[model samples]
Every structure is written in C-alpha cells, then in structure tokens.
Target: MITLWLFILIGAVIAFFWFGRQIAEAAQQHAVGQAEKLNVQLLSVACVKRRLAVLSNGRLGIKSQFAFEFSSDQQSAYTGTMHLENLRLKKMDIPPHRMG
Candidate 1:
C-alpha cells in the first residue's frame, strides 16, 4: 500500500509538469497567432507606408499609422492613425491589392 501511494504521488507530479508545459506552449502559440492576424488585417486595409508600434496600455495594443495611396488621381485616404487590441475578437476588411 505504501509503494502504491508513492507511485501515485510520482504520477501526479508528472501530470502536473506535463499540463504546465502544455499551457505554456499554448500561450506562446496564441501570441504568435495574434501577431500574424494583426499583420494580415493591417495589410488588408489598403495601407501604404504602414508602420506598427506596440504599446503597453494596460493591454497590448498595436498603433498603426498609414496612408492609402490612390492611382487614379483621386485623393488618397489616410487612416492617419489607429489602435487595435484583441485582434482575434474583430473582423477586418482590407483592400485586395494590399492583402497580396
């Protein structure tokens, strides 16, 4: 019975480590995914001369500054500046020429 208890304790420790590692890996993957999503969304907005700056405003937010250049002699629409957080929680529309 003593040996069995020891075995169970060791098993619990192993399980804890395994679970912790999985959680850590998941968090890392989530951050990477968010960054990629933000990049895609930024590109989709017809953004030219785009710049991204990260700021810690209690939450991680991306500050974007860009202009939409026009080729048809039309006035270019400049977004001027924008901030985005919780990228996965939002749907974004980006112009096709900028996305590719």
Candidate 2:
C-alpha cells in the first residue's frame, strides 16, 4: 500500500508539470498570433506568472498569464500580457506600439 501511494504521488507530479508545459506553449502561440495581427515583431513570450482563479463566468480554472516583449523597429521594446483560461485565450492586453 505504501509503494502504491508513492507511485500515485509521482504520477501526479509528472502530470502537473506536463499540464503547465502545455499551457505555456499555448500562450506562446497566442502571443505570436496577436503580434502578427498587430504587425509588431514578437521578441519573446515567456510564462512569467500563473494563478488559479474564478473566471468571469464563475468557473474555476487555471489562469496562465504570460509576459511578452515586442518591438516595432527592433530598437525599442514594449511589454504585453496574455491571459489563458485552461489553454484557451481569455484576454490580451497590449499597449500601442510605434508603426513602421
């Protein structure tokens, strides 16, 4: 019984990491798409923060927040944020960038 419990605990740890990785990938993809749509260059998208919270619809979910850096001319840098609810893009906040 002890060994069985240990195995279960190990499995849970692995699954948690796997899920986190998947969420990060999804956030990156969403960030890239947004940058393209806005005609800005995506410098980097990294999962800098995450939290569990009740969404607007009162549904409990993992809110994966990513901080992204972008540039319009590769000389100036700007910051942006992307929020995901269980791997689905819930919202994005990007400041105005200079146009080429």
- RMSD to true structure for each model, in Å: 13.9, 1.8
Question: What C-alpha lDDT values do all the predictions have?
Answer: 0.37, 0.87
Count: clashes, candidate 2 = 0
Clashing pairs in 2: none
lDDT score at residue 17, model 1, on the 0-100 scale = 62
Cα lDDT of model 2 by residue, 2-96, tens digit? 99999999997797788889999898889888888988889998887777789777898678889999999889999999888879998899988
lDDT of 2 at 80: 91
Task: Give each model's clash number.
Answer: 2, 0
lDDT of 1 by residue, 8-76 (tens): 999977965665444344433443454365443211222222223445555533333323222212232
lDDT of 2 at 32: 84
Give the CA lDDT, 0 to 100, for residue 26 in model 1: 41
Residue runs of model 1 more than 4 Å from their true location after superposition = 40-100
* Candidate 1 residue pairs that clash: 44-94, 44-95
